[model samples]
Target: MARGDGLVAARHLVHYGYKPSVYYPKQGKNELYERLKTQLTNLNVPFVPDFTEALKSADLLVDAIFGFSFQKPLREPFPSIISQMEETRLPVLSVDAPSSWDIQEGPPKEGPGAKFMPGALISLTAPKPCVKWYRGQHFVGGRFLTRSIADKYNIDVPDYPGVDQFIEVGVDADEKL
Candidate 1:
């Protein structure tokens, strides 16, 4: 998704004792895919193919198909995958930003027919403007920001008293950044 965030998250899942099935876009063979495959192998997980396995097998889904750097107009397979996920009504945790979501503009506009509620959106580093209308749980991750860096980016982050890596923001909370 966003750089190596998805792969990194999958690795974390392994550390947390969850068996994660990673389904990349293409069949696993290339150099990058091989690297990911090796990592997954080391973690004792499966690096599998997508489409059905992703929707039918997993208890929950992680929307890491795209992140903050994703541009407009999703290509083939991704849109279908997202539509299938939505139809399945599975609980999804969007990593950084939801797939098909415009990084700066949020979810795509329904052309006069639908109103869908996307599930939880987790923003790393800082909250993106795309999260404005998200009603579900909003979590802020990437707990490495110093006050000076936060201020430099005009991000008003709260003081993390200890070793907290994640801070959940309420749906109605004012994130002054």
Candidate 2:
């Protein structure tokens, strides 16, 4: 997996004494991935050998494999891994969007790759329209925003109670977002 969200989740899990297993099929060419690897080592996150190891090590999955902006079909072992995850019937907490999903179209039900159900989805900034199809818990993260920023982008800002950051958006959304 790439550094970004994966690294952040790994650090938090380790800090909380949870043995988070990271799945990196190959060494990343980016500087950020290298930095993340070092930080994760310092944090003592277990870099599992492969997808099976990571899946076996986890009770549930925190899917930080790909962010929402990704548009290409997943390559190689990724498709196999996604299949395993689907067959295993594990609860997946997808960050941003489910890995390899079309940014606007959501999961590809019938295609070369990607057709799994995530148990929960944590959408940052703003949720895409496809998030509506998610039957499980849908959480809207990221608090502390300016009204102008939300208005400019037309992102519906949810109200928080006493500094709470995340909101579990249920059915019957206020039509603000």
Candidate 3:
């Protein structure tokens, strides 16, 4: 809950008229995070202590616990947290990648990281390799990606429609409802 992605998501929720009750178990040491936390605090967003309590009252959960940098074999609190999230069967819109999911392998075939599948995923720059295994609504956002950078990386960024900040992209036909 101390990640920048989570912090930014919280900030946007406030901007968009959503009242987010953050479950920040550990406070971040970074100044950017502190500032974001302070900003959210100033806006009267409640930082709730109990994760289950927060989930019970939540309409939707935005999981930003981990991103592309995540490694295998999740540690304490996280596994429990993810398990709790799965138990709720709540609709989750994971930012970047689902927490504990392998960037290449996607969710594991079994065990700790397998059961939880986000209803939707918002890929930051471009979709990751794990997206191949993801069977849900997908969106891409990165207006800041320069042309040269895209060309250099051979990233096939779709042409955005109008001035939209984000665009929904089609997943595999089999994945469609």
lDDT of 3 by residue, 15-115 (tens): 99988878887675889889988988998988888897788888988888877878777777788888886677778888888887888778877766688
True-structure lDDT of candidate 2: 0.73
Q: How many residue pairs clash in all the candidates, one count each? A: 0, 0, 0
Which regions of candidate 3 fall more than 4 Å away from where they truly are?
172-177
RMSD of each: 3.3, 2.3, 2.9
TM-score of 2: 0.87
Instruction: Name the best candidate (by lDDT).
Output: 3
RMSD of 2: 2.3
- Alpha carbon lDDT at 173, candidate 3: 23
Ranked by TM-score, top first: 3, 2, 1
User: What tens-digit string does per-residue lDDT give for candidate 1 at 1-177?
Assistant: 212566777888899999877767734355775676678788887766666765677877777776776775667766777677566677878877676667666677862102334578778887777777577888887767788887788786755558887778854335553
Which tens-of-lDDT digit does each residue in 1-177 have in candidate 2? 444877778887788788877887757678888888899988877788778766765788887777675657677877777677667666788887777677667678775435676788888766766675566888888885699988888778888667876788862233454
Q: Count steric clashes of candidate 2.
A: 0
- Give residue 17's error in model 2 in angstroms: 2.7
Better of 2 and 3 by lDDT: 3
Model 1 spans > 4 angstroms off:
1-3, 26-37, 111-116, 172-174
Task: In model 2, state the lDDT of residue 153.
Answer: 81
**Colliding pairs, model 1:** none
